[model samples]
Target: MYRIMIADDEPMIRKGLQKLIQQSGQPIASLRLAENGIDALNQIRESCPDFLFTDIRMPKMDGLELCRHTAELDPDIQIVVVSGYNDFEYAQRCLSYGVKEYLLKPISKKTVEAALEKLVYLHSKHTSPAFVSVHRLEEWVGEAEAAIWSLNHETLVKVVQQARVEISSHRLRLHQLIDLLDEFTVLLFKRLHSRDIFLFTERAPLHAADDEDSAWSQFQARLVLFFDELRMKRRGKLKDPVEEAKLYIEAHLAEEVSLEDVAERIGLNASYFSQLFKQSTRETFVQYRTRRRMEKAKKLLAQPHYRITDISGEVGYADHPHFTKTFKKYAGCLPSEYRNKLGIDR
Candidate 1:
């Protein structure tokens, strides 16, 4: 059983959250509600609750200030920021203060339940010493972080799986195992952020399972999926901006194209785009466009139906002599001579 507190200026929000938590089936020994941060802080001083739920904006001692105070008073208390504001800065600030969860407004019952499950697991981990020690867990997390940074999928998965085996050998309850896994995830997130990866903003919610084996399997699958995403991002394979730019260039090859135009279209600065384009394609944007234009002109020249001047206009060159000069440089022969070698004449 655990004690919980909810602090918000809105009566409806406070009551609604209280009802949701009660129905969540968590082991709540007592639940307290406060209309403002000041009241919540006062209640916390009287008796610090196991968990604190608060809104960012409130009369007298806003939630941010309250979080600071609560962290100073009791670092053990798990704080969840239930704010209507979806600003990233607020969420980042709350995380800095060791807030466990940050839920946006219009909260859903499922989301609340998921958060409670993880927070309760955290509380149990804190109160019990039978589980792994802080130092050992830190060592495991450090190993996992190194593996993740190096994109060593095998070693990373092995590290987590080995930890799970040790935890299971202790014969902990199903929820405790699940909670410990969630705690490991939170720690992993913090570690990766310190390395500048920043893949996850919060601990991912676990899937509901009735048994330990199923729960463990689900967790393993989630870990594998996360690793795949990390690998792709590290390799620059996921949503490649250069690939997008290349597709745009291919489609508009016949139109007047500039590096600046392509960069702005793809939402990147012109200079950065130039560098990325060269790195990905091994050619400058102008070189690529020119090569593509010459390729198209050669294909059209083989037909003998289109005039060289018309081919020039088709490839975005209104100046016939300029097109001929570029084609000669690209193909090692004048356009007319190349056509003659193909056994076509106009």
Candidate 2:
């Protein structure tokens, strides 16, 4: 499915084009209209549509400049220019920017169809690539660590969706796919451990499922839950030096938050602060923090909008697997199960 946008100064022209495109029964997944180049540009930035149609003359920004800006922002987007002028210079200028079709003012269904045929062919040629390679998948997992940790739901969902697509396309054996998921989960754990965050939970043993679909579904669900608790180990409150340390931890949950770092921030000896935190909270600083994180995680899990990965980082665990494990230990159920018990649709 391809998304398309049309930008024109004339309201009638824009509505006509939209109607024509819909009536043509083309493979257009969606069609949007913008009154002028500025609105069109904003839409392009937000949706990054695969196709665009614009008039040569418009208020605020002309079609030529829109073409230039679109080329810079998304060179892959196919563009068709509609103009009243048949000037050769306009044609040459549009050609220089890789505009797909140059239609005259009196546009017809036949001409639009001809332009769409070319655009569809180009779109096909551009999008027939296979799944992402394993190397690239690893790179994305590493790059997504921060978003996964910070509870950035938008970025996290995008990355997870990409990974899901790649995994589905690979068609690996059930065991092989499980191994891949395990490897990725381990990478997340390694990232968290590097920051001295410790995590423990009952490892849900993987069985030989009948098919890859079951395993993949289970794995992704677990990962979603794991991500939900990533930052649980960093949220909490305390007294005096411990209170200051807790505040510091809350403010820096997305960073490499460490006991030493917080202790230093509060002008307390790290060793003494550790003992003091345990005495004050009846749990070690880490345990206290994890408990607080679990509390926050429970609240976030109740909301359908929060991704588990984002919640994991929000509470401060970067390694999603570890976050999941520790969350289960604290909450006595997997995050997803917790969400279900709360009668929420995840």
Positional deviation of 218 in candidate 2, in angstroms? 22
**Residues 168-193 of candidate 1: C-alpha lDDT, one tens digit per residue:** 66765555556667776678768777
* Candidate 2 C-alpha lDDT tens digits along 1-346: 6688999999999998888777766877779999989999988765567789999999999999999999987777899999999999999999889898999978888888888889989977775553346688677668567776676768867776787777677545344466666777667656755755544122243444546677666655555544544533344322355566777766665566678878777665676567556645567777766677788888889999998888888887889999899989988999988988988867
Candidate lDDT scores, in order, read 0.81, 0.75
Backbone clashes in model 1, listed as residue pairs: none
Relative to the true structure, candidate 1 has a C-alpha RMSD (angstroms) of 19.8
Look at candidate 2 and tell me the lDDT of residue 120: 88
